[model samples]
Target chain A: MHRIALQTLLFHRAKVAAALAGVAFATALMIIQIGLYEGLRSRASVLVNRLGGDLWIMAAGTSMVDDSELLATGAELPARAHPCVTSVRPAIVAWVPYRTPAGARHTLQLVGSDLRTAGPTHAYVPWSFAEGLPQDLLAQDRVAIDDGDLSRLGLAPPLVGSTLEIAERRVEVRGVTTGIRNVSLIPMVFADVETARTLAGAAPDGATYWLVDLADGSCGPSVARAIERDPRLDVMTREELASVTEEHVVTESGAGAALAFVALLGLVVGTVIVGQTLLSLVREHHKELGMLRAVGASRSELAQFVAWLSAFVAAMGGALGVILALLVQSGLGGRSVELHYGPGAILTGLAAVLVMCTVAGAASLASVLRLDVVKVLQ
Target chain B: MTDERGASANVLEARGVVFTHGTPPLETRVLHGVDLDIAPGELTVLMGPSGSGKTTLISILAGLLRPTRGRVVLGGSEISAMDDAEVTAVRRRTLGFVFQAFHLFPALTATDNVAEVLALSGTPIRVAREKARALLTRFGLEARLDHRPGELSAGQRQRVAIARAIVTSPRLVIADEPTVALDGPTAASVMELLREYVSAGTSVVLVTHDVRLVRASDRVVALEDGRVAYDGRGLAANPHGAPSGHDIHPPTPRSSEPVAGPEGA
Candidate 1:
């Protein structure tokens, strides 16, 4: 029985490939489309990872430091008194597009960090070194530029020692960085709190948020309540902040909902294409099915054959689709657009592809339901 | 051979079967009324030219087509009144049909095609494959077991079809021009394979335009138009069992003009 299932699918290997190709196109399109959305969200709040803080304390209702603002609040003081406060850093965002000394130009987000534990905040752009020398980015007038931004600025990649013009002020590119793409969607240059405040022309003591890094024993929920209890400010964890960003886009910017609708469209088109392709294959083999039936195969066995074939095709198509999306990732180079792919999305895409295949298989599956040996023999 | 597998006589009894095709202007009744009774284990040959209603009669006998009005009983089951699906179920376990074209599935190997019916029939995979291989080997096709129909000669493919038809051990086998696709030797070989089932008491109903099989068949039924022109014992036209009415040419060659396409009849 298993061999028959294998042989039946391979018997029309071409048709199976066609069906899978249809499904693969859909799965790939949806996955990559979502990848872009995720990439955009990551870029919008990348400062979270670098902030070295498990908890972000900010003025009431402060949504983002780069684009969001809040009135002066007591978000900084009490967070420092907690036993979990290994360290706290004042961080602000200053995004300004500037040309390089090498006659190239692009935008970079300038993030400030506390003189202490600043590496976790902005220094992560160069990538946090678990085993290498950490870039000391909080040096007075020194900043760190990402490898991607360095290349874009007409400078050689890994540009460890270079100069960046911080709005008519000279700031040395002290260290080259990595991982800037995951969060900023572009490039980032990190400097000390003093330098960032100077560049943005803001008051010296004004930090939009206090990033508090917890000690090893601190419980996330307990610390969250402790921080948010400060009446003067609100606190958001990384995961909470991400969901909020998604909610904001879904409800406010409409990007989240728009993409969801497109993804739904993809499902419809994909299922229709895959469904028709498989159904036609079944129609072509009506005589064969009759022979099988006359031989004594139950309707369920026939349905199994259709489903297995459709699933195999859909899975293959989905994998190829993902590869295709990755191929086009570089095409979005200049648009400050990026794409992210992780195991979670991959597995989800796979599950979705299987579902799509099952839907497509419904058409071919009709043969099992409607076949009558008497008609086929005629 | 009168073997144990040869069924006791009286396997099928058909009564007053009236068959029609299509509706409106295209409507046509092919069989006014037909009746037949066959004993188990006997080979029944239905011989006639195109449009003589031979195929239609064969379909009715095997319970593949519905009679516009009539009751056909097979192995004691009144199948004419059954629904299409019920009829197919009855056909699956009780009857088998050998087609003129030897319609073996192109994708499956010879053995798989033979085994496919067994698989569909709810036979265990291991047992079904074993039986399928044994059947193919019995038919002198062991060498071509894994070859697809497209890869086999017409005779070999016909033998595979025969194996597939008989693999389920149905009580009756109805063959419609089963050997037409083969050359003389292969056709004879195919006929011999089908005859082997008679030892198991399985009745064989072979329909053909060929006169070659007329003499060897246990019973011969001549279909003239939609009605049976002749049904006689001992197969041969002669009552003495010697070559009867020996002639170099047919006494009356009915209009040889091709009446419809090959599938039409």
Candidate 2:
């Protein structure tokens, strides 16, 4: 039965190729869409995830890392007073309007932290410099911009010393980083605390968040509770903040829903492609199928043949789709739009293709089972 | 249920078979009360003109269709009363078929096409192919074993179909116009192979309109206007034995012609 099924499918090479192309396209589309969604979620909680902190102290009701409100002056004091706290550093996350040297206007997500005092795991300041050192941001009126932001910010080859204005305060680009990104799709600017505060119109002592390092092996939840004594602030462990931020991006932002719909659309498109191919294949071979039935091929046998055909197409198409998705990810390497086709997303795509093929096979089996053996033989 | 001489058991017995198409006032009656018996170890040629229901009768005999009224017994089993699945099982185990168009699965090699029937009947693929290979080699298709139907000539394709039919060594072989598309020598060769099956005691029922093929048959049953017009041997078995410009049975009225119902049903 499998031999017949495979041979029959291969006999209609052009049609089977069309079905395979459609299946591969849909599978890659779904994988990429899901991957993009995951990339966005990861980007959304970038700061919360990458910062070397056991806990974060944010203004009350701050929903995500990118939308932090300015906390009271010295909000880090309460966290520092905790027995488990080894050090606490002020950090600021603020979005500011910027005018590039070329006079192009854009919004910039400014991140300010004292990277010198923070632990080595802290990436609040640009760790990978494309042109200059991380200490470049320590200079007065200086900010570090990522290589991805260079084209968007209208900064050409000579990135260093190119002056830009943020929130009406002129600043020079001292360093160019590589691969830093934000979900907001805005340029990311890293600077020291005072420069960020001055540009964002915050008081000298005011910070958007307080990054607290704990003594090695200290309980994070206990220390967070200690810092939560200040009613004007919300203290959470890094993991808790990252989770909440991801949830916010998925639920509140609506981007996740849109991406999920696209992923589902890929599935629906795949089903339609497979269904149409199966229908046409059965129709094309109606006389042949009837002859088989007349010659004593049972309905179950015919159904199995159809199933094997579908499985063949799906398995091959699924493997091709995974390869295509991986190629797409590789093609987009270091670009603004990040795609992460993890094992989970790839497996989901494969499973979805199988389901699509099964649905198509069952539909084709209807006509097979209803075949008129006598009429067909004639 | 036996032949005229009651020699051995009859391979098939059709008692008062009737087959109709459609329902009520719009119905088309294709076979009107057909009673036939086929003895083992003989070639019975079923002959009829267009719309005479010869195809319908063979289909009923093969259990591919059920008669409106009557019972068909094949190899001691009453097939007319069996449900589709049961009849199918019986057919798989006891019947072989050679169709007019050669209905070979176009995608499979000659060996695989012949092996398919054996495989369908629960034979392991490897063993089935071995048997198919041996059979096709006997049919002079040894050189064409790996070729698909499209790669073979009509004669070669028909040979493959024959191999597929007899692969299971069925008790009954039903062929419909098996040589209609073949040349003289090829058709003669096909007839010779079918005759071999008969000599082996496998009942062979062949449906054909050609009198040349009928002349070689052991017995011939001719149908006209949904009724049996003649059943005999030799000269009378000739389908065109009637006077020139005259039909054996009265010409059927145009209004009563079967409404193109499902294929041979």
Candidate 3:
């Protein structure tokens, strides 16, 4: 069929392109705006996602990774005894500084784990670079430095033969790996349980928390019941821990509010921009539209033409915005601004399209709807 | 308002028509009970002075305006009391319009501009374009089929407008002051095109104050101060009529040189 919509679109592509560009920018900004919060929250709790444990036993309200100090490590025995709880590990986590042989100091999330029961907690850590596992880490003063920490140590990347001084103790950097990092942009340092305890001068009787893992599906309630039998323990499954983490990011930190503000600003700015551009174009074409109506084009046909133009531009802007975001964010500060595409991003973008395009179209319609076809018959 | 039954083979007929402009309190009534009939296969010129309601009368005859009191019938349908939708349907199905300033779409191809009416009425694009091309060819505009309005000459643009109007094969073509900008010869050729449409059996109701146009007109209705002051088939008025304020409300002749080129040799 002859497409009045397509004809009009071709006629107005320049104005449409300009309008769509605004939406594209808004899309990019909205993504990046939300990304800032995601980025910061990821920084605040990198250990949650990366922590290999299937369940976390922390203080009742402590969800943030850096919220608590070492309690009693023996807290795991109660949860481990549950029929649903197959394994548990005692893990030590702290923020500390280390000086490499190159003499540069960098902060690290120093984690200590027992080599034997480490499957529940330590599996997520990058530990292959370490010369050995949790062989009394606080005993011998040996250290496992992440490649990022090693780079900051100015040691020219990881070398098994290097040494470091952490917590006023000299230690060998016997291993190197990736993906282990600290909250607030720090690197990670790994050491054996005993050696880390000795190096940090920690009391062995106290532990960070018991990292628990269940065997299979539907084990959460039974594990919770068994762990609750102990007054000192609070058991949370993986999803629950994630939820708590989300709550921490949303409520406890101001980052969430700021991101929301920026996203809203993006939408408003886009609405203004898209609305202005479309309305101007509509004004320019109002006489022509009047002529068309005078000659027998229906109001529905005109509306369809306009709506299709908007949706095409919006959808194009959406796709272009996503591509541009990825392109620009990848090179930002030599670091990738992470884009997490869940179902929510799609919904958010669609909302942006509807809000932006509809507002723009409505603005244009203010003038367009009055196109005195009667006045224009000549 | 009532249709004039048994009306001659005229494509449009107006009986006792009255028209007014503006809203109440500030409104000015223009036309006062005018009567007219435009026969099929004939070119009729409607000429009048500024504020004389010639454009208003033409607008009513084209089914674009509903007369306040009397009836104007187009394509056998009385239009004075019809709703906007019904009026539009009659115009789309039976009427074509050619204006002084060619209203070719500035962005569309010549062929596409001609084809637009069919598309608005749901004609498939390919066939509509094919018909548009054939119409342009008939008008000797085939070579400029892809040119936009901005690219065409004054005469060519008007030709394109004529092609666009007639491409839909409307039985009635209403033209309003089609030569206010053209030289005498160009205007003459434009009128010749209207005459060609008449020869092809399309009725034309042309509104102009330019007397040069009356030569091609089979019948002429001269309106003055909102009434039909003269109605005949004589071509003997001012051999060169100037622009009416009705179309382009004229200024004080601007050095008496407002007329372009020469009048008829």
RMSD of each: 7.1, 6.1, 6.7
lDDT of 3 by residue, B1-265 (tens): 2347754566877888888778999988888888877767878787878888987887778766778878887887777778877888888888888877676667788888888877777788789899999988877788999898888889888888888778778888888888887888878887778778888999888888777677677666678887776555524223344333222222222121222222221
lDDT (0-100) at residue A159 of candidate 2? Answer: 78
What DockQ does each listed candidate score?
0.31, 0.56, 0.38
Q: Write the per-residue lDDT of candidate 3 for residues A87-132, one digit (tens) a residue.
A: 7766667767767666766666777766554455456443544344
lDDT of each: 0.69, 0.82, 0.69
Query: On residues A125-148, what C-alpha lDDT tens digit does candidate 2 reach at each position?
Result: 656778887677776689888888
Top candidate (DockQ)? 2
For model 1, residues A178-278, the per-residue Cα lDDT tens digits are: 55653435567767677777776667776766666677634666776777776677788756665575556444677767877887787778888888877
Stretches of model 2 off by over 4 angstroms after superposition: A84-87, A103-105, A120-124, A133-142, A160-174, A213-231, B1-8, B23-29, B234-265
- Give interface RMSD for all predictions: 2.9, 1.2, 2.3
Residue A229 Cα positional deviation in candidate 2, in Å, after optimal superposition:
5.8
User: What's the lDDT of the predicted structure labeled candidate 2?
Assistant: 0.82
